[model samples]
Target: MRSPRRGNAFEQAEAAFKAATKKNEPMPKAPVTPPAGKEMVSLRLDRDVLAHFQDDGPGWQARINAALRAAAGLDPA
Candidate 1:
Protein backbone atom coordinates (compact mmCIF):
# COMPACT_ATOMS: atom_id res chain seq x y z
CA MET A 1 0.00 0.00 0.00
CA ARG A 2 1.14 3.56 -0.72
CA SER A 3 2.24 5.60 2.28
CA PRO A 4 0.13 8.53 3.37
CA ARG A 5 1.41 11.92 2.17
CA ARG A 6 3.11 13.90 4.98
CA GLY A 7 5.69 16.60 4.31
CA ASN A 8 6.13 18.81 1.21
CA ALA A 9 7.73 17.37 -1.94
CA PHE A 10 11.32 18.37 -1.15
CA GLU A 11 11.17 16.94 2.38
CA GLN A 12 9.58 13.70 1.15
CA ALA A 13 12.17 13.33 -1.62
CA GLU A 14 15.02 13.93 0.79
CA ALA A 15 13.61 11.31 3.19
CA ALA A 16 13.27 8.78 0.37
CA PHE A 17 16.84 9.46 -0.83
CA LYS A 18 18.22 9.01 2.70
CA ALA A 19 16.39 5.69 3.14
CA ALA A 20 17.52 4.41 -0.27
CA THR A 21 21.19 5.31 0.33
CA LYS A 22 21.36 4.13 3.96
CA LYS A 23 23.68 1.23 4.80
CA ASN A 24 24.47 -0.93 7.84
CA GLU A 25 27.88 0.62 8.37
CA PRO A 26 30.25 -0.96 10.88
CA MET A 27 31.10 1.00 14.02
CA PRO A 28 34.41 2.85 13.94
CA LYS A 29 37.31 1.52 16.02
CA ALA A 30 38.44 3.44 19.11
CA PRO A 31 41.52 5.66 18.77
CA VAL A 32 44.86 4.10 19.79
CA THR A 33 45.91 7.22 21.77
CA PRO A 34 43.60 8.68 24.39
CA PRO A 35 42.06 12.11 23.84
CA ALA A 36 44.31 14.98 24.97
CA GLY A 37 41.69 16.98 26.86
CA LYS A 38 38.52 16.48 28.86
CA GLU A 39 35.88 14.23 27.24
CA MET A 40 32.14 14.87 27.18
CA VAL A 41 29.96 12.78 29.47
CA SER A 42 26.48 12.87 30.97
CA LEU A 43 26.02 12.86 34.74
CA ARG A 44 22.94 13.17 36.95
CA LEU A 45 23.31 15.54 39.93
CA ASP A 46 20.86 16.56 42.61
CA ARG A 47 18.92 19.79 42.05
CA ASP A 48 20.66 21.56 44.95
CA VAL A 49 24.05 20.36 43.72
CA LEU A 50 23.42 21.76 40.25
CA ALA A 51 21.98 25.02 41.63
CA HIS A 52 25.02 25.54 43.84
CA PHE A 53 27.37 25.47 40.86
CA GLN A 54 25.01 27.50 38.65
CA ASP A 55 24.57 30.25 41.25
CA ASP A 56 27.67 32.07 39.91
CA GLY A 57 26.00 32.24 36.44
CA PRO A 58 29.17 31.71 34.37
CA GLY A 59 31.87 29.01 34.75
CA TRP A 60 29.35 26.67 36.47
CA GLN A 61 30.52 23.61 34.61
CA ALA A 62 34.18 24.34 35.33
CA ARG A 63 33.35 24.90 38.99
CA ILE A 64 31.54 21.56 39.14
CA ASN A 65 34.50 19.83 37.47
CA ALA A 66 36.88 21.43 39.92
CA ALA A 67 34.71 20.35 42.86
CA LEU A 68 34.70 16.78 41.56
CA ARG A 69 38.45 16.85 40.99
CA ALA A 70 39.05 18.16 44.50
CA ALA A 71 36.81 15.50 45.97
CA ALA A 72 38.82 12.92 44.04
CA GLY A 73 42.05 14.34 45.56
CA LEU A 74 43.34 15.60 42.21
CA ASP A 75 45.09 18.95 41.71
CA PRO A 76 43.06 21.72 40.03
CA ALA A 77 44.91 21.92 36.72
Candidate 2:
Protein backbone atom coordinates (compact mmCIF):
# COMPACT_ATOMS: atom_id res chain seq x y z
CA MET A 1 0.00 0.00 0.00
CA ARG A 2 1.18 3.58 -0.67
CA SER A 3 2.38 5.61 2.32
CA PRO A 4 1.18 9.09 3.15
CA ARG A 5 1.26 11.49 0.19
CA ARG A 6 3.94 14.17 -0.02
CA GLY A 7 3.25 17.88 -0.79
CA ASN A 8 0.07 18.91 -2.76
CA ALA A 9 -2.24 16.06 -1.82
CA PHE A 10 -5.07 18.28 -3.04
CA GLU A 11 -3.45 18.58 -6.45
CA GLN A 12 -3.23 14.79 -6.71
CA ALA A 13 -6.81 14.44 -5.50
CA GLU A 14 -7.95 17.10 -7.96
CA ALA A 15 -6.30 15.25 -10.84
CA ALA A 16 -7.91 12.00 -9.78
CA PHE A 17 -11.28 13.76 -9.40
CA LYS A 18 -11.01 15.30 -12.87
CA ALA A 19 -10.16 11.94 -14.38
CA ALA A 20 -13.07 10.28 -12.58
CA THR A 21 -15.44 13.01 -13.73
CA LYS A 22 -14.49 12.39 -17.41
CA LYS A 23 -16.38 9.11 -17.60
CA ASN A 24 -19.46 8.57 -19.77
CA GLU A 25 -22.07 8.90 -17.06
CA PRO A 26 -25.09 10.96 -16.15
CA MET A 27 -24.39 13.56 -13.48
CA PRO A 28 -24.35 11.84 -10.09
CA LYS A 29 -26.22 14.71 -8.48
CA ALA A 30 -29.52 15.10 -6.68
CA PRO A 31 -32.20 15.61 -9.35
CA VAL A 32 -34.07 18.87 -9.71
CA THR A 33 -37.77 18.08 -9.49
CA PRO A 34 -40.74 19.63 -7.79
CA PRO A 35 -40.73 18.70 -4.13
CA ALA A 36 -43.10 16.04 -2.89
CA GLY A 37 -45.94 16.88 -0.49
CA LYS A 38 -43.52 17.34 2.40
CA GLU A 39 -40.68 19.78 3.20
CA MET A 40 -42.48 23.10 3.03
CA VAL A 41 -41.57 26.54 4.28
CA SER A 42 -43.55 29.48 5.60
CA LEU A 43 -42.72 33.15 5.42
CA ARG A 44 -43.72 36.12 7.53
CA LEU A 45 -46.25 38.24 5.71
CA ASP A 46 -45.95 41.81 4.49
CA ARG A 47 -47.43 44.50 6.68
CA ASP A 48 -50.73 44.97 4.75
CA VAL A 49 -51.45 41.26 4.35
CA LEU A 50 -50.46 40.60 7.93
CA ALA A 51 -52.85 43.31 9.02
CA HIS A 52 -55.66 41.80 6.98
CA PHE A 53 -55.07 38.34 8.44
CA GLN A 54 -54.64 39.81 11.90
CA ASP A 55 -58.01 41.61 11.68
CA ASP A 56 -59.53 38.48 10.22
CA GLY A 57 -58.34 36.49 13.27
CA PRO A 58 -57.54 32.81 13.86
CA GLY A 59 -58.87 31.12 10.73
CA TRP A 60 -57.47 33.75 8.38
CA GLN A 61 -54.63 31.64 7.05
CA ALA A 62 -57.03 28.80 6.34
CA ARG A 63 -59.34 31.25 4.64
CA ILE A 64 -56.48 32.49 2.49
CA ASN A 65 -55.51 28.95 1.59
CA ALA A 66 -59.10 28.18 0.70
CA ALA A 67 -59.34 31.36 -1.35
CA LEU A 68 -56.20 30.49 -3.27
CA ARG A 69 -57.47 26.97 -3.92
CA ALA A 70 -60.79 28.38 -5.07
CA ALA A 71 -59.06 30.78 -7.44
CA ALA A 72 -56.98 27.94 -8.87
CA GLY A 73 -60.16 25.82 -9.28
CA LEU A 74 -58.76 23.15 -6.99
CA ASP A 75 -62.02 22.62 -5.14
CA PRO A 76 -61.63 24.44 -1.87
CA ALA A 77 -64.92 23.02 -0.63
Candidate 3:
Protein backbone atom coordinates (compact mmCIF):
# COMPACT_ATOMS: atom_id res chain seq x y z
CA MET A 1 0.00 0.00 0.00
CA ARG A 2 1.18 3.58 -0.61
CA SER A 3 2.23 5.66 2.39
CA PRO A 4 0.31 8.81 3.34
CA ARG A 5 1.45 12.14 1.89
CA ARG A 6 3.29 14.37 4.37
CA GLY A 7 4.20 18.10 4.24
CA ASN A 8 3.62 18.14 0.46
CA ALA A 9 2.41 21.66 -0.35
CA PHE A 10 1.76 20.88 -4.07
CA GLU A 11 -0.18 17.71 -3.24
CA GLN A 12 -2.12 19.59 -0.53
CA ALA A 13 -2.96 22.42 -3.00
CA GLU A 14 -4.11 19.95 -5.66
CA ALA A 15 -6.32 18.21 -3.11
CA ALA A 16 -7.68 21.58 -1.95
CA PHE A 17 -8.48 22.63 -5.50
CA LYS A 18 -10.28 19.38 -6.17
CA ALA A 19 -12.25 19.75 -2.96
CA ALA A 20 -13.20 23.37 -3.73
CA THR A 21 -14.25 22.69 -7.33
CA LYS A 22 -17.92 22.06 -7.97
CA LYS A 23 -19.00 18.44 -8.23
CA ASN A 24 -21.49 17.21 -10.83
CA GLU A 25 -25.04 17.68 -9.49
CA PRO A 26 -28.11 15.96 -10.85
CA MET A 27 -30.04 18.06 -13.39
CA PRO A 28 -33.25 19.47 -12.00
CA LYS A 29 -36.49 17.94 -13.25
CA ALA A 30 -38.90 20.11 -15.24
CA PRO A 31 -41.66 21.82 -13.28
CA VAL A 32 -44.76 19.70 -13.00
CA THR A 33 -48.15 20.93 -14.18
CA PRO A 34 -50.65 21.61 -11.42
CA PRO A 35 -53.62 19.27 -10.92
CA ALA A 36 -55.87 22.37 -10.99
CA GLY A 37 -54.59 22.79 -14.59
CA LYS A 38 -53.34 26.31 -13.96
CA GLU A 39 -50.17 27.08 -15.88
CA MET A 40 -47.63 29.51 -14.50
CA VAL A 41 -47.63 32.78 -16.43
CA SER A 42 -46.38 36.33 -16.36
CA LEU A 43 -48.89 39.14 -16.86
CA ARG A 44 -48.39 42.87 -16.57
CA LEU A 45 -51.08 45.02 -14.96
CA ASP A 46 -51.41 48.73 -14.12
CA ARG A 47 -50.36 49.66 -10.57
CA ASP A 48 -53.85 50.86 -9.59
CA VAL A 49 -55.51 47.79 -11.03
CA LEU A 50 -53.04 45.60 -9.19
CA ALA A 51 -53.53 47.57 -5.98
CA HIS A 52 -57.33 47.30 -6.28
CA PHE A 53 -57.11 43.52 -6.40
CA GLN A 54 -54.42 43.39 -3.74
CA ASP A 55 -56.21 45.72 -1.30
CA ASP A 56 -58.08 42.80 0.23
CA GLY A 57 -54.78 40.89 0.38
CA PRO A 58 -54.49 37.08 0.37
CA GLY A 59 -56.24 35.32 -2.53
CA TRP A 60 -55.53 38.46 -4.57
CA GLN A 61 -54.40 36.16 -7.34
CA ALA A 62 -57.74 34.35 -7.20
CA ARG A 63 -59.55 37.70 -7.33
CA ILE A 64 -57.52 38.73 -10.36
CA ASN A 65 -58.29 35.38 -12.02
CA ALA A 66 -62.00 35.77 -11.27
CA ALA A 67 -62.03 39.31 -12.63
CA LEU A 68 -60.21 38.25 -15.77
CA ARG A 69 -62.62 35.34 -16.28
CA ALA A 70 -65.56 37.68 -15.83
CA ALA A 71 -64.12 40.19 -18.30
CA ALA A 72 -63.51 37.40 -20.78
CA GLY A 73 -67.14 36.28 -20.33
CA LEU A 74 -65.92 32.98 -18.94
CA ASP A 75 -67.22 31.33 -15.77
CA PRO A 76 -65.32 32.26 -12.58
CA ALA A 77 -62.48 29.88 -11.93
Candidate 4:
Protein backbone atom coordinates (compact mmCIF):
# COMPACT_ATOMS: atom_id res chain seq x y z
CA MET A 1 0.00 0.00 0.00
CA ARG A 2 1.20 3.55 -0.72
CA SER A 3 1.73 6.00 2.18
CA PRO A 4 -0.56 9.04 2.47
CA ARG A 5 1.03 12.35 1.42
CA ARG A 6 1.19 15.17 4.04
CA GLY A 7 0.58 18.09 1.67
CA ASN A 8 1.30 19.17 -1.94
CA ALA A 9 3.99 21.78 -2.77
CA PHE A 10 1.44 24.36 -4.05
CA GLU A 11 -0.70 24.08 -0.90
CA GLN A 12 2.38 24.42 1.36
CA ALA A 13 3.58 27.46 -0.62
CA GLU A 14 0.12 29.12 -0.43
CA ALA A 15 -0.10 28.52 3.33
CA ALA A 16 3.43 29.95 3.85
CA PHE A 17 2.65 33.00 1.68
CA LYS A 18 -0.57 33.68 3.64
CA ALA A 19 1.27 33.36 6.95
CA ALA A 20 4.12 35.62 5.78
CA THR A 21 1.68 38.30 4.53
CA LYS A 22 -0.51 38.25 7.66
CA LYS A 23 -0.49 41.57 9.61
CA ASN A 24 0.34 41.65 13.33
CA GLU A 25 -1.33 43.91 15.90
CA PRO A 26 -0.01 47.49 15.89
CA MET A 27 2.40 48.55 18.67
CA PRO A 28 1.21 51.13 21.20
CA LYS A 29 2.62 54.68 20.91
CA ALA A 30 5.08 55.97 23.53
CA PRO A 31 4.89 59.42 25.18
CA VAL A 32 6.89 62.09 23.37
CA THR A 33 9.02 64.61 25.25
CA PRO A 34 10.94 67.77 24.33
CA PRO A 35 14.74 67.74 24.00
CA ALA A 36 16.80 68.60 27.13
CA GLY A 37 19.06 71.09 25.20
CA LYS A 38 21.93 68.60 25.01
CA GLU A 39 23.62 67.81 21.71
CA MET A 40 25.74 64.78 20.95
CA VAL A 41 29.33 65.41 19.85
CA SER A 42 32.55 63.51 19.30
CA LEU A 43 35.46 64.33 21.63
CA ARG A 44 38.96 62.94 21.89
CA LEU A 45 40.85 62.77 25.18
CA ASP A 46 44.19 61.37 26.37
CA ARG A 47 44.16 57.67 27.21
CA ASP A 48 45.19 58.27 30.85
CA VAL A 49 42.57 61.02 31.26
CA LEU A 50 39.82 58.72 29.96
CA ALA A 51 41.14 55.88 32.10
CA HIS A 52 41.06 58.11 35.21
CA PHE A 53 37.37 58.89 34.76
CA GLN A 54 36.48 55.33 33.80
CA ASP A 55 38.35 53.79 36.73
CA ASP A 56 35.49 54.74 39.08
CA GLY A 57 33.17 52.22 37.35
CA PRO A 58 29.62 53.58 36.83
CA GLY A 59 28.67 57.25 36.18
CA TRP A 60 32.06 58.01 34.64
CA GLN A 61 30.39 59.95 31.84
CA ALA A 62 28.43 62.03 34.35
CA ARG A 63 31.62 62.68 36.28
CA ILE A 64 33.36 63.84 33.12
CA ASN A 65 30.41 66.14 32.34
CA ALA A 66 30.47 67.62 35.84
CA ALA A 67 34.23 68.17 35.67
CA LEU A 68 33.93 69.89 32.30
CA ARG A 69 31.12 72.12 33.55
CA ALA A 70 33.20 73.06 36.62
CA ALA A 71 36.23 73.81 34.43
CA ALA A 72 34.10 76.05 32.23
CA GLY A 73 32.74 77.92 35.32
CA LEU A 74 29.18 76.74 34.78
CA ASP A 75 26.75 76.28 37.68
CA PRO A 76 25.50 72.80 38.48
CA ALA A 77 21.95 72.03 37.47
Q: What's the TM-score of each model vs. the native?
A: 0.51, 0.37, 0.52, 0.53
Per-model CA lDDT versus the true structure = 0.90, 0.75, 0.88, 0.89
Query: Better model by TM-score, 2 or 4?
Result: 4
- lDDT string for model 3 (1-77, tens) is 99986759998888899999958898999997765868788999999999999999899999998888898989944
Count clashing residue pairs per candidate.
0, 0, 0, 0
What is the Å distance of residue 8 in model 4 from its true position?
A: 16
In candidate 1 the C-alpha lDDT for residue 66 amounts to 88
Assess the local accuracy of residue 39 in candidate 1 as a C-alpha lDDT between 0 and 100.
83
Q: Candidate 4's residue-wise lDDT over 1-77, tens digit each?
A: 98987699899899999999999998998877535976677899999999999999998988998899999989655
Per-residue CA lDDT of candidate 1, range 1-77, in tens?
99988999999999999999899788999877635787888999999999999999998999998888898989745
User: Candidate 2 local accuracy as lDDT?
Assistant: 0.75
Estimate the overall C-alpha local distance difference test score of candidate 3. Answer: 0.88
TM-score of 2: 0.37
Checking candidate 4 for backbone clashes, the offending pairs are none
Per-residue alpha-carbon lDDT of candidate 2 for residues 1-77, written as tens digits (9 for 90 to 100): 98987559899898889998886867689877645653445877789976776697798866776776788999945
